[model samples]
Target: MSSATQRRVFLVAALLVAAVALGVISMGGIGENLVYFWTPAQVHENASKAVGATIRMGGVVQADSVDWQPDTQALTFTVGESAVDTATPITVHAQSAPPQMFREGIGVVVEGTMTDAGTFRADKVMVKHSNEYRAPTDGMAPADLYATVEEL
Candidate 1:
């Protein structure tokens, strides 16, 4: 082959290799940062896959299963798929204090990993609440919901 043609081939090959390397490096970074979100039922279903990885389980805190020990700063609760879901519930233990809005029948997203004991160990507990703001209906008018200079 001509020297010019050989140089062109070498340049094309290097570009291809650099592109593949860049793609692989980017994917590794993205995968490492990704934390999967699943429900209690999904966690059970994917037990083998969910173990020992940082997972965020989204579910409702079971009313009767909540046990908060302020003395120990440990909160344990069972999360179900939903308030009425009776089929599946997963126990979650958080060493940190529960959020102010964390309560029975409330939607929560617990970020942690599944243990061999079949319980989730949460490092962070996030309470899910409505984004839409609704004014109080207890004798409060629409204007009462907003702040005004007169009221201040």
Candidate 2:
């Protein structure tokens, strides 16, 4: 008895399979794989869709614009917006080997891609200390491996 044009083609194929299963369930929802660390004024306000994509900026490290050349391990710098204020800066350019708490104004994140002559060509630098676990007021537990504070 399925008359009326086969029940309107089975209700338009069940509303077109519920709109393609809600567009693939909103593409696996919930930020899919959240990992944003852009700063330095959000990478100069997304500098034209962030040059070539791969981002993760972050800031502070522009004191004398460090130029670590540990025998050519190469690692230029210049990522301000704090550390007494160097305003908007962003000249990363890393090649590797520079960690050991890296110095000058600290706080970095780097990651990569943004050249076109604007610099920030890192591959991955990340050096933002403070995991917090200070249980050594110096009674005899001296283990200060690269411990730094430079000023609270």
Top model by TM-score, which number?
Answer: 1
Candidate 1 error regions (>4 Å): 1-36, 137-152
TM-score of each: 0.65, 0.28
Tell me the tens digit of each residue's lDDT in model 1 across 26-62.
Answer: 7767655564578888898889988899889999988
Per-residue lDDT of candidate 2, residues 29-76 (tens digit): 634456467777777877987889888888788778788787888989
Cα deviation of 89, candidate 2, in Å: 28
- lDDT of all predictions, in order shown? 0.87, 0.79
The 10-residue segment of model 2 with minimum total lDDT is 143-152
lDDT of 2 at 88: 72
* Model 2 alpha-carbon miss at residue 47, Å: 22
**How many residue-pair clashes does candidate 2 contain?**
0
C-alpha lDDT of residue 101 in model 2:
76
